[model samples]
Each structure stands twice: as structure tokens, then as C-alpha cells.
Target: MKATILVAEDDRNLRRVLRAMLVREGYDVAEAPDGEAASAWLAERRADALITDIRMPKMDGLALFRHVRERHPDVPVIFITAYGTIGDAVEAIRSGAFDYISKPFDEAELLRVVGNAVRTSAVSVREGAGGEETGGWFGMVGCSPAWREIRKVIEKAAASPLSVMIMGETGTGKELVARAIHGISRRGKGPFIKINGAAIPPALWEAEVFGYEKGAFTGAVTSKPGRFELADEGTFFLDEIGDVPLSMQAKLLRVLQDRAFERVGGVKTLTADVRFICASNRDLRKETGKGRFREDLYYRVNGIPVHLPSLRARREDILPLADYFLARSCAEMGIAGRKLSRETAEILERYPWPGNIRELENAVGRAVALSEGEEITPPDLCIALADTEEEEATPEEMRFHESVRDHKRAIILRAIRKSGGSKTKAAEMLGLQPTYLSRLIRILKVEG
Candidate 1:
């Protein structure tokens, strides 16, 4: 089947040039004078790929790219921009544009990029038709046996009404797994409320979890519903469950056991048909032994424990995950047609992702941002796998002496400085929830 390519360029001559080139290459070509028209065309017809200019009349390339990503994940995109910068190219790739070409680009180069994009689009369609679930079940993507086994367990767990405990290293996608189970369960239509257990400070734990009555405490101007109440007949994902305070754990336990909870200052008791799914990077057993985590709560949440595999443990899945991340990152950034070079793939597969999936995702995003060309390289990733080759370089004693708190302080300060005092940007750089970063900043006493 001939691939259909949509060309959106305000420049009439360039649009003709692109359309002519693609049509001559045996592709069914569609042209729109601007992004708005292109987006309209996209709404009706299925285009294998999109070729758009960075600048357009009503809508720009970035905006169009976002539209395509949200509506058409299967169609690959190629961007053509005269004002291309390293930053622009990086942004394009990170946004999920299939590829970017500078103005006055060689016809050969354009053809090559388009060919690749078309091929990718075809592959996506084929996979979707083959029932591969490229987006995976509920946006989780993995093909490894480990992942399959985990999915089977999640499937079984989803069938029941039992509480589930997810165990994994930070960034191993524990919440994603929880969501997958929720999405497949009987309560799929219900709200999936996620709360970071650590983000809620000690004083606000009750107000946040159980909510408060009007004028219950200082600044409690109105009655508010808690996460549990909001997640009625849904799934409540308590992330970083290990960080939940011992006192709060008992309250959570009561809700789990009785399926009933009371507002902070309300006399009336509320009932919720909510499912509990807890996740923790820390070993709850160790926390229980240390008298940090409640034993009863631990036993209750661990009704059907599911473990997520780290990237290093599932090495065979690294490349696939990398590709998925790359695609997602680019799509989100409104850039498309970016690809990993063979060498980059090797670097990613060989690196032991200590930070696991989260780390790998950050690495891929960094690579896409840093890489200038169509292909991402090792240097583009900017990942220093020191432990990979020099595991013994740092002495255990020296490592042990390093203060984690001090190290974290330094890192936070660096991110703050680099982002020019923007907490939002710093949070993005650190891959942290902005609220969580704000809490850390206050707790760590970071100066503005």
C-alpha cells in the first residue's frame, strides 16, 4: 500500500516542492496551506505521516504536532523548519516529531526521512492490527517474559476486590502497574486517585486523606472531600507508601478494613467502595522491623503483592522500552521522526539503569534533547555509567561516609541554580512532582 503523506507548509513553493517530491517517490500526497487546515484534514483522513513547517499561519508546527500526538499516535511526523536550532531540533525530537529538516535541505535527505517515517507508521499500524497492544494494556509497554508474568498477576489481581501492594525500585513504574490493574478491573470507570504519601506533611495528613469539615482547622474555609472520598468506587494509589506516618497508617488501615472513614472534623461517617493499591520503593518488611511501617497495614495492603522488574533485570526489554520512551517523549514535545542509532541502542542496553525505568526515561529525554541529528548517539544520552566499568573505584567506606542528606541538598541547590530559581523548571529537570519538590525545598531549608 502506498503511504499517504500530509504536507503542511504556509510557503506555497516549499509545499509544492515537498508534495512533488513525495508524490514522485510513489507516496499519496496531501497538502494543506497551514497547520489548521492540516489538522482539519487529519481529522477526516488517515495520513501515514505528517510533514509540517515550524511556522504556519493560525497554528504552528509545535501545536499541530501536539494535536497529532494526542489524536494520532500511529502517524509519524516529519518537521521542516528554516529556523532550526539545536534546541529546536531537540525539542522537535522530544515532542515526538518523526524527524526535522532545515530549510534548503537536500531532497535526498528529505526523501530518506520521509521513507523512515512512513515505514514507522506502517509498523505501528501492523502492530496494532496484530493485537500487540503497542501502548500496552493501559499505557504500560513491555514484551519481556518478566513483564508478561507481571501482567498475568495483575490480571488475576484485577479480577478480585482485594487490596494490592506493588513493590519496586523508584521509577520502576509501580503506579503505572497499579493503574493498569485498575483500568482492567470491574471499577475501570471509577476515578483513579493517586496520592504521594510523602508529600503530605505530618500536620495535614488527616486533612488531606480524610478531608476536613468547614472551619475544622485554621484556613479550613469550606468542607472538602479527601482522596478516599473522591476515589469512591474507584482505585486509590498511595505512592511511596513506606513514607506514610505510623499514625496515618492506622487511619488508612481503618478505611481499608471497614470501607468506612470519617472526615477530620465531621461527625458523620462516610462509606466508599474504593480499592486500595499501595506502592513503595522501600522494603516494607524492613520498615516494619524498624517500627516505621504498621505491621497490620502492611499485611492488609499486601493482599496480592506484584513486583515490577527493574530495567537492568530485564535487559532484553531495554531497547524496546527506550524506543517507547523516545516515541512518547517526542510526541509530547511535538517533535517527531527521531530515532536511536544502533550505537545509542547498544549504550542504552549495556547501561545498568540504577534508577530503573524512571532513570532510563530521563536518559532518553536527555539524549533526545541533546541530539542534533536524526539519530541519537551515546554522548547525546550524557549518562555516566561509572558503576558499569568502575564498580570498585569508590571504596565502600568512602561511599558509606557520604551523607545522603547533604548530597540531596547539593543536588537540589544545583537544580535550583540551573533553572534560574524556577521551582517548576527545577522540578522538571529533577523529574520530580512540583509539589513534592516544593515540600523538599521547605524541608531542606533551600533559599529562594
Candidate 2:
């Protein structure tokens, strides 16, 4: 069956043109002269996608898009706007609109975005009722094969009694993985305590991981149960284990082996009934080989290694992750959830996320707070785009014998193409000022 596209525009000429174009592309077209008409049409039936002007008679695209997201989340909505309403359109995109096309947009571009919206709508059919499959496995989200395989590994590892080590880059949700293991294990009902090895001072690691005696030091006025004691008969997560000092590693190793420790400045030995789950962005084996980490400690915490793929390595999860972040941020900030445009999604997927999921979450939160309208646009996510431009290199540029000049020129060309020939947008995408992009275009003799 041909996908049905509803076009809601007050401008008769633009509506007719869009209908004619969609029809030529073999789509069944529905026309709405205003937001009111579009809402009325939606009341009776559904279209695969919606394209509405930001400003329409009786109602507006922003309101209509919100209505659709609430009532028919699977039906993607796109906005049509003039230059004056670009900001409003962007806000709509962040709020949940599928995408938007500016006035005088290329017919090809329109068709491309509409096609994406239609494809997204079909994909939603498989996403169940929540617009995502967040299986009942500890708040973990993503439908990628890597994520699925990781879930299986987590379940198997959780069922075991051996200590587990989670390895991944910073912001790769290692802590979440640890919590998931704890939540699924037999000790799920017990306390799940965590300590950041990197955050605690080397001198205080002992006192923090083990109980401290009263008057242990000048500031020790009272005895306190350490992280391990707090997590007795439960799970203890040591994050950034690679950052733990060599001296502390020996003490930690002793506790893991003996399952006992003495309070600081006290002779009474205490046994801890705790499960260990260690995490680190660094390679523990390499650290041990370098004589910076204890070999014995490394082996003790690495009984089962669970490595998480970075966001860049699992590009398929980017959009779902973004949506998850947006929803969470919106809820936390008391704002409505936003959606990503296909164009924005493409940019996110193309970018190499060096900082991983943590970075993505921060970026989404920033976008949500800064976005003035319903949807998030490219500008709203420019901080991440800037980071991507600085650290990421394209395949063509990474090849041997690729000259510096050629790489620079290629970057400029790609940015321009990605920005649809808008120098300002291209500059933003490239993390360069508009004047710099123009200068480079002139110097490279590239057609702008």
C-alpha cells in the first residue's frame, strides 16, 4: 500500500505543489488547509506522516504536532515554515515533530524527509506501545544487536557468584550495567553500594572501603561503617578501579581474598559478605603490566569481563538513546518530551561520540533546556556537533597519503552539502565561524 502523507498548509499554492509532488512520488496525499482541518481529519483517520505549516489558521503546527504525539505517536509529524518561523519549527522538532522543511526547500529534499517520516512510521509499528522497547531488564534501552548480546551476557553473568569487571570508555553506562547485575542476582533485595576509586583520595581509600575506628585520625570523632560494610550481604561496585593507587590495590586485593578487613587504627577484624563488581575505562591488564596496578587485584576483580560498546561503535542505538535522554530530561525539567528530526538523527548517527552515552545525555539535556519550542533542531545540538568536528575524522581523510589540504577541503565540502548549501549552517556543523567557512570555500575554489 502506498504511504499516505497529509499536507496541512494555509497557502493553497504550496499545498497543491506539495500534494502534486507527493502524488508524483506515488504517495496518497491528503490535504488540510489549516491546523483545524488537520486535527479534524486526524480525528476520523490516520496518515503515515503529517506536514503542517508552523503558522496555520485556527490552530498552529506546534499545537497540532503535540496533539499527534500524544494521540498517535506512531504517526510522524513534519513542519513547513518560512524563514521567520524557523526557530518555532526547530522547537517543534525537539518537542516531537519528525522533521521540518523550510519554504523554497528543494522538492528533492521534501521528498527525502517525507520518505524518512514514512519509514519511521513503519518502524514505530514494531516498537510496541511505548515507541521503544525498554525490556524489563533494569532501565537499559536499545534495540541494536550489540545491546541484545550484551543483555544476554549481563543475565548470564548476573546469575553467577564470581566477581565481574565491566570495561568501557567513560560515559558508556558501566555503572548501570553493574546495577543491572545486582538487580538481577540473588542478592537483588540487598543494598547495592558504589564507590568511585577516582573520586576518593589515596590516603582515605582504606577508611572509605573499610570501617574506621573512633579517633582513627584527627577528624575521626566517631566510628563509621565503610562502603563494604554498608554493602554487606549485598553488592559493592568499585568504579574507575584503574585509578585506585597501587598501595590501595594491595589492601583491596587482601579484602577480596580474605573477605575480612580491620578498621582503621583498630585491631578488630571484620568480615564483609559482599559481592564485587568493578568497572574501569582503562585496561586493567595493561595497567598491571605497566606495574601501576596489582596483577593479583586485576585477576580478582576480572573473573567475568563485560565490555560495553561505545556509542560510536553502536550507531544504531543513537536515536533511541537520544529519545530516551530527551524523555528523561524533559521529565526531570518539567517540560514536554522532544523528538529528533531525521536530519538531526542523521547528524547524531554520523558523529563519533567520544564521550559515549554520558555525553549524549548531557547534550540532550542541554538541548532540551535551551530549546524554546517543541522540537530540538540542529542549532540546539550544536555543542555535540562541535565536539564531533574536533575529534572525528572521516574515512577518506584517515586513509594513507591523504594531504592536509585535501582533508580540509573535503571537510568543507561535506559540511556544506550536509547543511544544504547554507554557509551559516555549514559553519555550525564544521565548528567554524561563517566567515572562516566562506574564506575556506574561496581559497579552495569550491563551488558554494
Candidate 3:
């Protein structure tokens, strides 16, 4: 099928030029004089890709891009940028546009980017048709098997009425997983209340979880509902559940058992049909064994256990996640799209991310801030590899690692291609176990 490329440029001459370029590349071209026309065109027809100018008369490209993102997320949007609107274009890319090319762009470069956008759009459509969720499922960007399994668990847990307990290392996106469950569940439209068990003081735990009556304490100015009451018929996410004070565990267990609780100093008991979602970085089972956490409460909250793997275990997702973070940092800082240098990508993939996804995000954000040019290098990352008990690699060592990675990646790509994109067949061809081959592919970042 011929891919349709929509050209939305205000300038007629430029639109003609874009149309001609796309048509010559064998793409079916559609032209819109401005963003509004493009929006109207999209309302009735489907385009595989969109190329829009930043500044248009009615509904600017930024607004149009947002419209398309909400209405047609799979359609890749590219920006036709000028020197003056380069910042806006970068912001668009950060907001999830496919790509951008500055004015007076090389015809070849424009065609190459458009071709990529069209191919990506095709894949997205295929995945959507196949009932497979995209990488941006609930704002979690990952394609590794571990990530896919976590998502499956989330779907099952969200469908059930039982409480969900998410266990993971710190910075492994436990809260994010919790939120995803709530966001897709039957109670999705309801409020999602959250509290950190470790953040609240022991003395304030009851008031925070079960609220306080007027005149209950010295600072009680008025009656107020707590998180549980606030989250009635909704989901209450208790973060760091293992950190809940021992004294308060019994009260929590009672609430979980009965779904009824009394405000401080109040005789009347209130009931809330709230679903519970808890997360803990600490091992609650061990805590229970040590008598630090209540045994019954642990079982109550652990109705469904969802474990998020550390970032290092899902090496294939590193570069994709880095790109996600880079886009986010660029948007937050209002900077142009900055890429990771080849050497920097090698370093990121090799580093033992002790802090997990959060650490990687911070590293990317720091690099974005420290980077002066368009590329983020090792120095820009400023990561302390020595902290992982390994000396930082010299330039020669880094180059050697890159060379090895590239060679392995090439060989794996060849095997997969020869096997017609079957990893199992590819493993057979390579004379390696399928699981081990999958690991190597992930470690080498061979799959997009």
C-alpha cells in the first residue's frame, strides 16, 4: 500500500515543494494550506504521516500536533521548521512528534525522515490491530519481555477487585505501575488518592489515613476526610507500605478487613468502598518475619503481587528509555532535541544502574542540562561509574566496547532477518538457546 503523507504548510510554494518531494519518493501526498485544514482532512481521512509548519494562521502546528496526538496517536507528525521556530519544533518533538527538518532542508534528508515516519506509523497500526499495546502504555515506555509481563499482570490485577501490592526496588516505577492499574480498572474514573507510608510521622499516621474530627486535637480546626474517605469508590495507593508504623498496622488491618473506620475521637464509623493498591521497596515478608510489619496486614494488601524488574535486567529498554527521558528533559528545559553520542550510549548501556529507572532519568536530565552542543557525551552524563566498583573506561576501552557491540548487533540482525523475524528461528540459526539469544539481543540493544 502506498503510504499517505499529509503536508500542512502555510506557504503554497513550500507545500508544493513538500508534495513533489514526497510524491517522487512514491508516497501518496495530501496538502493542507494550514493546520486547520490539516485537522479537517484528518477528521475524515487517515494519513500515515503528517508534516506541518510551526506557525500557521488558524490553529498553529503546535495546537494541531496536540490535536493529532489525542485523536490519532499512531500518525507520526513531523515539523517543517525555520531558524526562528526551531525551539517550537524541538518542543513538538519532545511532545511526541516523529521528527523535524529545518527550512532549506536537504531533499534526501526530508525523504529519509518521512520514510522512517511512515514505516513507524505502519508498525504502530499493525500493533494496534493485533491487540498489542504500544510502548507508551500508561506512560510506561518499554518493550522488553519483563516489561510486557509486568503489563500483563497489571491488566489482570486491574480487572480483579482484590487489592494489589507492587514490590520493587526503589526507583523501579512502583507508583507508576500502581497508577496504571488504577487508570485502567473499573474505578478508573474515580479519584486516585496516594500517600507515602514512610513520609508520615507515626503520631500523624491515624489522622492521615483515617482523618480527624473537629476538636479531636489541638490543631484540629475542622472535620476533614482522610485519604481513605477521599478515595471512596476509588483507589488509594499506599506507597512504601512496609514503612507503616507497627502501632498503626493493626488499625490498617482492621480497615482493610471491614472497610470501615472511625475518625479520630469520633464514635461514628464511616465506610468507603475503596480499592487498595500498595507498594513497597522493602521486603515486607522479611519485615513480617522480623515482626516489624504485621503478618495479617501483609497478606491483606498483597492480594496481587506485581514485581517490577530493575532497569539493568531489561537492558534492551535502556536506549529507548533514554530517548524518552531525553525528550522529556528537552521539553521541561525548552531546549532542542539533544542526542546521545555513540560512545555515551555505549556507556549508558554498560553502566550498572543501581538507582534503576529514576537514576537513568536523572542522568539523562543532567546530561541535557550540561550538554552545550546537540550531542550528549560521557562527560555530559557525569555518572560515577566508580561507585559501581568499576573503574571508568578509557576512550580506547569505550571504543573497543562499541566495536564489539556493533559487531554483535550486526550478526544478530542478520540472523533475525534470515529467520524472517522469528527470534526462535534466529536462535536456531545462531546455534544458541532461544532464551540466551534473547538476552544477547537485549544486552546489545538490537531491537527497537
Candidate 4:
């Protein structure tokens, strides 16, 4: 069946053109002269996607977008705007519009955005009512006691409109918890904008968060909405919050307190009704005490504190998470599903995953790619299982030096095998000099 597209524009000629363009692409086209008529049409029927002009008679695209968000959350809305109103269109994107195109727009760009919207809408419908699968609890996959407690906190946090702070080690899924909070909240249908403090430079921090006018900087050719503005009536995730510069913390705090900020170079004050979800590997309280982070900002953003335990702490979740990753990897790689051998499963459960869930997922993906048999073995995982045994051994049962040598040998052998027995490639994989690897290979008596 052809996907249906609804075009809402006040200009009769432009609406007709849009209809023709959509029809040419083999899509069923519906036309509305203005937002009011579009809303009326939607009250009785459904369209796979919506395309509307930012400015329309009787009602505007923003109003229509809000209505669609509330009534038909699955349908993606695309905005058409003049160059002068690009900021408005960008704001709509922050408020959950799928995409936008400027006037004098290329027909190809419009069709491309429309095609994406239609496909995304169809996928959302197929996924279920909430438009996303929540795995077990809002897309988190775990049944451990720690996870159950975290779920309670997430449910309570989502019920309120307060800011959230998720604290965890680097790969313990802090961002996943932040997303779960947003997905289950009242702002679930709204945009979930995120920024990594560590990734953005200190020089561009202000403009990146608060936006700027076209002439604000050397490369600023056009006005752009910041993450906060885009996140209006939604959730804004601040990843690696501890990495935010001290100079910017006060500005962030002010926004959180007053919900108002001006563009970097412009004086017009903009306010966003956003719920902030912050995550950090560092403890903000310690940073505040060390004067590296502002105490006031810490207090403001840390309205609710939730901590995710490292994978090792929640050992029972390891096998389950590995299996989940295995199935997902198989599907993504377009390969037949494979199961973990009994020894491999035991090794995975016993391994202390220092890098946590993210590392485990990578390992599973690698195993899926490398495993040629119906079952993944310990060797296919490319992990030093000897280290796990060494850690579990009592001092009386095994000599520390012997265990260390064995662990090193196991790791070197695995790397060599994974590199197709090339010492140069194995050295690169092990982050060792080729001469060093050769020396170790001789000392450890590891032979192909």
C-alpha cells in the first residue's frame, strides 16, 4: 500500500505543487489549505506523515504540530519554512517535528525527508503503542534487584517534573537510564536532546547550549536553536555532566533555576520548559568540594540521584545481557543465531567486566562475527579467561607469578589467533611493540 502524506499550506498553488510532488513519488496525497483544515481532517482520519508551512492562515504549523503530538504521536511531522523563519522551524524540530525544509526548497530534499518520515512512522506503528519497545522497563534489559530498584526510582522520577542525575561508571548504562526516564515521562512524545560536555569544546559551550544569531561568530552563517531550545517541553540529557567547564556551570544553573536564557550574541531571552537529565562518571559532590564544579549547579541538576551498579556488582545480569546482545548482533549482522557454549557462558559469568555492559556488548558482537560454529566458544570471545580463574584462585592454591604468566600467555595467544597468526597484527591488537610481543611469545613459550 502507498503511504499517505498530508500537506497543510495556506497557499493554494504551493499545496497543489506539494500534492503533485508526493503523487509523483507514488504516495497518496491529502491537501489542507491551512492548519485548521488539517486538524479537522486528522480528527476523522490518519496520515502516515504531515507536511506543513510554518506560517498558515487561521492556525499555524506549531499549533498543528502540538495537536498531532498529542493526538497522533506516531505520525512524523515535517515543517516548511522560509529562510527568515528557519529558527521557528528548528524550534519545531526540538519539539518533536521529524524534519523541516526551507522555501525554494529542492524537491528532492522534501521527498527525502517525507520518505524518512513515512518509514519511521510505519516502524513506530509496528513496534507497538508507545512507538518503542521498552525491553523490560522503558528499554532497560535487566531483572536484577539493583535494576528493580532503579526501575522504581525511574517510575517515581518520571512521574514528577524535576531534574534527574544518574551516576555510574563509564559503561554502566547511565545514558540508558536517562533515556528510560524520558521515555516514560509526560514529555515522552517530546524530543530527547542530548549533549556531551566532554565532547564540546569550552570555547563553543555557550553557543552550543544557548544557540546564537547568524552573525554571532565567524562560521555562523545562519541562526540555529540550541539543545535547550530544541528540548523545550521535553527532556535534555547532559552526558558527562562532570566534564562541563566551571565557567559554564553558573550559566547552566541560572537556566535551570529560571528556565530562561538569551542567545549567545542576541539579547532576546528564550525560555524552555525542559526536564534536565544529567549523567556522570565522576561524583559531582567531590568536584564541588574540590571547586572544580559549582555547588549551586550541582544542587540544581541533581534533583533526584540514581546510581547504576557496575555489571560485576550485578553478576546475575551478565549472562542475560550477553544473550540479549548475541541475538541482537545476529539479527543486525544478518547471520543465523548462535548460542554460547557451556564453557563460554561460564567464562562470561565469571569474568569481571571492568568496562561493564558496553564492553560486554562489544565482546558479544565480536564473538558473533568471529564464531563459525553453531555455538560460541571461549576462544571465539577473544577474552583472557585465565585472568578470571587467576582472580578466583586462593593464594595457597596457585602461585601468583605462575598465574600472571598464564594470564599473559592466554591473552597473547588469543590476540595472535584473532589476528590470523600474524605477530604484527597481534602486537597492534595488544598495544605492544612487535619486538615486545615476540619477546613475550618466546618467554611464555606460546606456540601456534
Candidate 5:
């Protein structure tokens, strides 16, 4: 698929030259006279790739780059540098610029690097969203070891009535864990009520959970069932449970222990039969220690902890999850599923996803909305994630090791190709002292 690149360069002549070169390579080019114009353009429409000059007027490239890092963190930016300012070029890269090229680089190099950058960014954005729990039981998107362990935990949790506490980052799908727990529990046939702890008012929290009778307050018209009563004989998922206000924690603690509550205006107590499942993005232990959360309440709700791994923690699931989101999002957006190129998939694997799954879903949706072709190419993804809001990939990039293995294999094949199946010549050509190549070649199981 052809990519749309937003180009920002102060020099009109240089911009013309670059735009022409990119157009020839079959890319959709957007031109901006300066950084300010480029920023406005990005705000107006998400560009697939961004190319800007470092020394442009009215928002230099660096300043623009920082802005992108803040506003559109996913959009990857490249700095165009003259040959002498190699130091500045290097600095651009150091400061999170994808890559910079010397002024004299031919159109081929420009196209290749720009194409790579576009592909890398696009994939990152799409896969980054895979960390979310969009995929539940029927939606669980992977077969990774981490996910497999999670499944086992869910199965065990499902068979019992023990309260569950799920912990993970924002997009990691803590609620999905709650659902899985409900699906497996004996009360799986019953209603599953989900309430966001952070979404409720502190004052209304008790009433929301325990119900209130008529005249409970000025606005109370009649008695109403609370979430606990509604979820009786079933599961109740409390999301962002750590956000529960301190003043209300004591009352909540008592309800958990007593497994019953009396309506706000009624003296009669009502019993609850709901299976409690709590989800939190914070460390409950830390919160408990900090005196912000009740220690007794923590243990009560954490009878069985279901830990959801972050997207980055389960790298093997990235592409599969990305493809799933791609198809789902495309369908929702009234488009076709865009195919992923092998190279683009590799780029997805290379980056660390700090935002986890939710970020990935949003990126995929954004890509689908902005898709310009049948396939979701690397460039398409890059535009979605370029700029700054760049999610941090795991510090230990797995792809580097994968690349090393790939490069080593390529070198062996090249030596043999250059030697015309002559092991001795290949060994000598490869600079191996003697029969070392033969031994190495055998170990590698070279086809030739």
C-alpha cells in the first residue's frame, strides 16, 4: 500500500525535491513549508509518516519533535540534516528521532529508511493496543505461555467462590479476568454485575453497592436493588477498587465480612450471595502499607489473586492480537481487514509496548479510520503511532536477539553462495583460519 507522509522543510526547493522523490516511489506526500504548518497538518489529519528539517523557522524540527512527542507521541519523526551536521543528526536520533539522513542521500536511501520508519511506527501503534482485554473467553487472543498460565488460574478461580483480586496495568484487561472468573464459577449462569470503583462518587458508593430504601435521601423515590443484590448468586466485578474512598472503606470492609447490608432507610438487613471479584491498577499491598487502603479489606478481597500480564510481558501475542484487532476494528469501521507484511510484523515485535492492550486497540481503530488501502502496511501503522506519546517497549528488546540469529544465518549463506558450494573456499572467504567454516557450517546445517 502507498504511504502518506507529511513533509516539513523550511527550504521550498528542498521540500519540492524530497516530495518529488517520494512521489516517484509511489508515496502519498503532504507538504508543509515549516514546522508550524506541519504541526497544524498533523492535528488536522493523522499522517502516515513525518519528515521535517531540524532548522526550520516558526517551530524548529526539535521543538516540533517535542510537540509531537507530547501530543501525537505515536507519530515517528525524522530529521533531515545536511552532511556536516552529522552531530546534530546523531542528536536527533538520540532525542528519539527515528533516523536522519545526510543531505546528499539518493532517493533510494530516503525511500528505504522512510518506508522502514513508517512501517515500524504503524505496527507499534496497532500491536500496542493488543495489551487490552478486548478478547475475553471467546475473545482471549493468544496461546502464549503467560496467557496459558492465566487461563489455568482462571479455571481454578472459576471452580470456587473465593473473592478474586486482579492486578495489571490500565490496558491489560483486568475486567476480562473478572469475566473469565465468572464464566468458570458455578454461578456462571447468573448475572455478572461490573461497577467501576473510580467512576462512583464516594458518598454514593455505599448506596450503589448496598441499595437504599425510599426516603434514604432527598432524591430517593423508592427502594432500589444494589449491585451486590443484583449480582446475587452470580459475580460482581469491582473495577479500580483501589480508588474507593478511605471513609467508605470501613463500611465496605464490614459488608464483605458480614456478607449482608441494610438499606439506607430500612432497619432490615439483606444478605448477598454474589461472588466478589476486584480489579485494581494500583498495588494494594503498597496502598495498604501507605495507610491509604485498609489492610484487612485487602486480604478479604484478595483470597485468590489473578495477575494479568502486560502486553509487553507477552510478546508472542502481539501480532496475533494486532491481527485480531485489525479485523475487528476494520469491520466496525466498515472496511476490510488490512493484511500485515512480514517486515511490518517484525517491526511490531521489536518495539516495547508500555501502554499495554488498550493502547493497541485505539491505534488499530485509528488505523482503520485512516486506512488508505487493502493492506495495513508498515507506513499506515507508523502514522498512527508517530510523534511522541511513544509507548515504552520492554527495555530488553527480544527482536535484537532474533535479528542476531537472522544476521548470523545470512552471513553463513552468503559465504557459501560466494564460494559456489566450495566449503574450503567459503571458509577461507569468511576469514576463518581453516576448517572452522566446515565445522560451523555443519553445526548450522547449511543446505548447500
Candidate 6:
């Protein structure tokens, strides 16, 4: 794709000349008369490169550059100033400015300066500080193949402002995925607002997500900005989206479809110009088939369904992730870094991480807090694991007579839970048939 550039200058003639010259060179160019306009422009769309004059009314290039750096520090910036203000340009250079081109310079020189600045900026972005290759977002902190695939999908999804649904068991870092996508997307400069769709009551869902005008409903004392409005020009993350009532799902679908919504008791339609990223632990497809969720809405939200692999599927990453969190936990406590003994690492690998990555982080955190030494041993982790018996299960102890019955019964139970109590889904989750599942459930005396 051709590079898109933005020119921020107060002079109208300069803006016109720059636009004409850049367009002739086959570059997409946007013009802003001042930093205020430039900020608004950036808030709407992302640019490959930004060129601004240092001084302006309302807001200056330094302030705009600072904001851009804070939001998207990777975006290249070029500042133009007269020779007299070269000192200010020098300051900009120290603050991560792309490059500075003195005023009254040739058009060719300016073009080369901007082009080179953009190229260099992209290179530095990929090779982050300390000359290390940047992988995914900062919080992901895993080099596992499973994590790598998750990162690749998030990067691709962030390019567009489409809605994304991430489904995983609880404590799988669903929110981290949402934040990573938003942080890398064009809307990185916009606000990022998150809300849990499960905790709020059905009566408050509308007011919470779509806001409300004064006196819209009882206890609606004044106007309030909802999560959708607050996230305009940015990303809105809805956690536990499957928990939303079927009635509210229709409203969500309308806003997603039209990119617009209206506050309660308000006639005029307001636009929700933002990216929607929803996550849930429930099987939304099964929910729709069972008449508990809207079919259309399910299709809408699951446009790009990303299923995060459970921790057990990628057991190779357990030890490395545990060590990473162990170091972090020690630093947080102002204690010496803790090393996980090889024995401890082996134990961690054997325990099925039913709670996934979140559980691992917590396990390490608790170990660090409870242990007083620099080395975390197997005893430390074992004590931590024993506190939670959610993974408790017995071996296939039923000999000859009951062995067949016990194994089949366990499979049936797992499938039913995974399928949200639907016979068809249970069959699908376990790779069985509806008839087989029905027979097993009857024989096993399964309870819904």
C-alpha cells in the first residue's frame, strides 16, 4: 500500500502546495491548518507519516507530537520550522521526532526527508528498544506457538475496525487480547473502554452500553455517556458477551450493523463509530440453537471467531511462562529474583492447568508471596495447587466390570458440560452422535 501522509501547517498556501506536490508523487496526503485540526484528524484516522510546524495557535506541534507518541509512538513525524527556531526542533529530535526539515527547503529535499523518516520509523518500530524483535503486545509475554498464532490473528484483525469475538475459558487473558488488538490498530489513538456484559442487570444493560438521556428511566437523574459513546473513534471491549440477555443482543446487532445507536428516551440517532471486540467463555452457537441467544447477533459478533487454546493443549509453554511470571512477581515485591527449581518446573508441567494462563500467573504469584527464598521449589507450588481442588479426579479404579462404564461416563459428562447441556452440542464437542450421547446420558443418569 502507498504511504499516507498528513501535513499540519497554519499557512493555507503551504498546505495546498504540499498536498499538490505529495499527490503528484503518488502519495495519499491529508492537510491540517493547525495542531488542533491535526489532533482531530488523527482521532478519526491513522496516517503513515505526520509533518507539522512547531508553532501554532490553540495547540502546538510539540503537544500534538507528544499525544501521538503517547498513543502511537511508532508513527513517523516530521517537523518544519524556520532557522531561528532550530533549538525547538532540536528538542523535538530528542523527544522521538522523525526528522526536522528547515523551512524554505526544496520540495525534493522535503520529500526525501519525509520518505526516509517513515522508512526509518517502521524499522525502529519492528526492532524495539534494546534491539530486540518485538513480539505481540507487552502483556502477552509468551513465545509459545499457541501464543504466536494468537498474536498473528490479532495483528490482522486490528488492521480493520470490524467486530471480533474471542472465546476461551475463564482466566485465559481475553482482555489482554482485546487490548493488544486495539493497541496495534489504526484506532490506537482513540479511547479504549471495556465493560463486563455479565455483571450488569438486564434492566441496566441499555443505560450502561448505550447511555441515557435525562429522565429516560426511573433513577435516570441526568445524561450519561455509555461505553459505546465513550469508546467512539476507538475500541470498545465487551467481556462475557454471551451473558447478555437475548433482548439486548438485538440492540447490539443494530448498532454493529448500522454503526449507530440512540440513547434511551432520545429520538435522534447517534453514531457509534468505534471497533467492537467481544469475548465470552460460552459456546454462542449452541446458545443460539437453544433459543437463548440471537442467531443474527451470533453471526454478527463471531465474524472472526478466535478460540484461545487452553493451557493444557500447549503444555510446552508452561515452564517458560511460569519463570517469566516468577521474575515479575519477585520484582513487584522488591525481593530478589526467584528461580524455579527444575523439580518445581516438572511438577508444574504435570498439573493440568484447568484455569489456563491466568491460573498459572496466580500460582506463581502465590508461590512468590509465600516462599521466603530466592528459589521456588516443588513444595511451594504443590502447596499452592492443593488449596484449589477444582482439578480433583480419580484414576480409572473400576476394574473389569465397571471400567468400560466409568470411562464412557466421564467422556459423556465432559461433553455435556462443554456443550452447555445440549445433546447435539455434547455430541459435537466429544466427536459423538446425538443418538450415542442420548444413550450414554440415559445409562450414566446424567443430570442437566
Q: How many residue pairs clash in each candidate?
A: 20, 11, 0, 1, 29, 0
Candidate 1 error regions (>4 Å): 1-134, 383-448
Instruction: List where candidate 4 sits over 4 angstroms from the true fold.
Output: 1-136, 384-448
For all predicted structures, in order, the TM-scores are 0.60, 0.58, 0.59, 0.65, 0.57, 0.57
Tens digits of lDDT, candidate 5, 115-181: 6567656543442232113343635777799999998998998887788998888778676677777
Candidate 2: tens digits of C-alpha lDDT, residues 1-448? 5788989999999989999999999999999998889988987666999999988878888888877866676688888878788768655553446566767676765776687667657634421122312333565678899999899999999999999999988777787788789878999888676666765667767876785786787545445556676777789888778888888888899889978998898898899888999988888899988999888888899999999998888889888888887887787568976887776777788878777876676667767755667878765665334322334666875552234345456556666787788888776554455786677778657764
The stretch of ten residues in a row with the least summed lDDT in candidate 3 is 125-134
- Residues 227-322, candidate 1, lDDT per residue (tens digit)? 677777788888778878887889888999998888988999999889999888789999999999899998999999998778788887888878
Best by lDDT: 4
Supply candidate 4's per-residue lDDT for 4. 87
Model 1 RMSD, rounded to 1 decimal: 18.3
What are the C-alpha RMSDs, in order, of all predicted structures?
Answer: 18.3, 20.8, 19.5, 12.7, 21.1, 21.3
Predicted candidate 6 versus true structure: per-residue lDDT over 326-369, tens digit per residue: 87778756888889888788878988877777678767876775
Q: What stretches of model 6 exceed 4 Å from their correct place?
A: 1-136, 387-448
- Candidate with more favorable, higher lDDT: 1 or 4: 4
Can you list the residue pairs that collide in candidate 4?
134-139
| Worst 10-residue lDDT window, candidate 6 | 125-134
> lDDT (CA) for every model shown?
0.74, 0.75, 0.78, 0.79, 0.71, 0.72
Q: What is the lDDT of residue 143 in candidate 4?
A: 77
Is 5 or 6 the stronger prediction by lDDT? 6
Tell me the lDDT of model 2 at 410.
59
